[model samples]
Target: MTIRVVVADDQALVRTGFRMIIDARDDLEVVGEAADGEQAIRLVRRTSPDVVLMDVRMPVVDGIEATRRIVADGAAARVLVLTTWDIDEHVLGALRAGASGFLLKDIRPTELVDAIRGTARGELPLAPSVTRRMLDRLLRTAPRMSAPDGLESLSQRETEVLTLVGQALSNAEIARELALSEATVKNHVSAVLRKLGLRDRVQAVVAAYDCGLVRPRRP
Candidate 1:
């Protein structure tokens, strides 16, 4: 199935560039474009695209608010936030607002395309260089000092799986680290998310950090 997308950025050039690359892919299609967050929401509602390439700094409304509204309304479209700054606090806001993942604006075309596909598939696509710092900041600044009620339900093995996931390790990688079958790791991951009341792995990552289940790597 073609992955339908909407590119919402204030710059015409950025939108055009994304549209060009996306349309070149046989499995991807650019269904619409919007110049700002408000337009993005309208376009999303109108097209019901599988994914949205959302820019965080748009006028009229910021991407974080737009994402919050979209998720709150229970729309099927998933948001993939794109920004020039990888470590911007807005990235955290966007994630908390229900973005599937985030990408640096300078990401390679192929990576961007892959991120779009991954987001559509309900996978998180964090920028490699920013994950550690982002998670660290999330740990420090996330509002709650204690674990959420559902978080305590995770088993010890499940907690370990969640920590690796917060580290942004893929299922195969997690399996390799834990000496478990990939299927078992997948089941653990599913249980972790289900028990934590998270929407996807991205939220799980945030929760893992927020609850101090994962720690930052030393420099």
Candidate 2:
């Protein structure tokens, strides 16, 4: 199946570049282009793309708000946020706003394509560097509070899986850590998301930090 996508960036060149790359793939199509967040949202509603390539620094509505609105409106299109900076508040904001993945602008073309596909597949495609930075930021900034509603519903194994996920372990790594098959780990991760009402693993990581399930490392 061809994955429809909307390229949203304030810079015309960036949008064009992304469009060309995405359109070059047989399984990917650029259905729309937007120069700002509001336009991105409108395009998403009209085209119902499988994924949106959102720039966090766009003018007008801005990508984070656009992502929040899209998710709130129950749009099926998953958001893949692109930004220049790796560790920053905007990245966290995008995550909280329901982005399915985050990638730096310097990411290779092939990696960006893979990220879009992964997001469409309901996987959290965060860059490893971004993931580590995001977790560190969360530890410093996110409030240490009670678990979000529905966390207690998780089985013991599910809770274990969530902890591992929060630590930025991939499904295969989680499987290795727990001595289970990768498929089993994926199932547990899915269950954890469902039980926690999380949009994706990004949110799961936030929840892990919020609830103290994963502790910050000592200096």
Candidate 3:
């Protein structure tokens, strides 16, 4: 299936550049483009794209509010925040506003394409750099909420799986660590997310760090 995408950026050049790369892909299509956040929201509502590439800064509305509106309205389209802002506040704001993941604008074309696909597949495409920034923010700030009530329902094994997920390990890596098949690891990951009412692994990671289920590494 072709994943439909909408590119929203204040810069015409940025939007055009992304459209070129995305339209070149066999499995991806640029269904629409927006010059600002309000337009982004309107395009999303009209086109219902599978994914949205959002820039944080814009003249009207701004990406954060646009993302908030999209997710709050229960749109199926996932938002992948692609902005030049690599700061912790922007990353946290986007995630809290229900972005599927965050990536810097400087990401390679191949990585950008993969991230959109991953977001469409209900996976978080958080970059390592973004993750590091997020972790720093998490360590310094209190969680937005105690956690979803479903967190208390997780089994011990499921909790362990969530902890590994917090570390950003793939299912195969978690499987090897626990001496389980990759399939089993995937199951655990799913259960963990379901039990916690998380939208994706990115939220799971934040929750784990939030509730102190996983501690920050001593670097």
The candidate maximizing TM-score is 2
Clashing pairs in 3: none
Expressed as tens digits, the lDDT of each residue in 74-185 for candidate 1 is 8889888888976677888898888888888888899889888888887766553465555565445546445656877889999899889888788888999999999999
- The clash numbers for all candidates, in the given order, read 0, 0, 0
Local accuracy of candidate 2 as per-residue lDDT tens digits, 1-219 = 999999999999999889888999999999999999999999999999999999999889999999999999899998988888766568777877788777888888998888888888877675644575555854676556567899879899998998988887788888999999998998899888887878787778878887788876543
TM-score of 2: 0.90
Q: Choose 2 or 3, whichever is better by TM-score.
A: 2
Give RMSD to native, each candidate: 2.3, 2.1, 2.3
Clashing pairs in 1: none
Candidate 3 lDDT over residue span 169-209, tens digit each: 77777899999999998889889878786778877777787
What lDDT score is found at residue 205 in candidate 3?
Answer: 78
TM-score of model 1 (CA atoms): 0.89
lDDT for model 1, please. 0.84
Taken over the whole model, the C-alpha lDDT of each candidate is 0.84, 0.84, 0.82
Worst 10 residues of 1 by lDDT: 137-146
lDDT score for residue 107 of model 3: 87
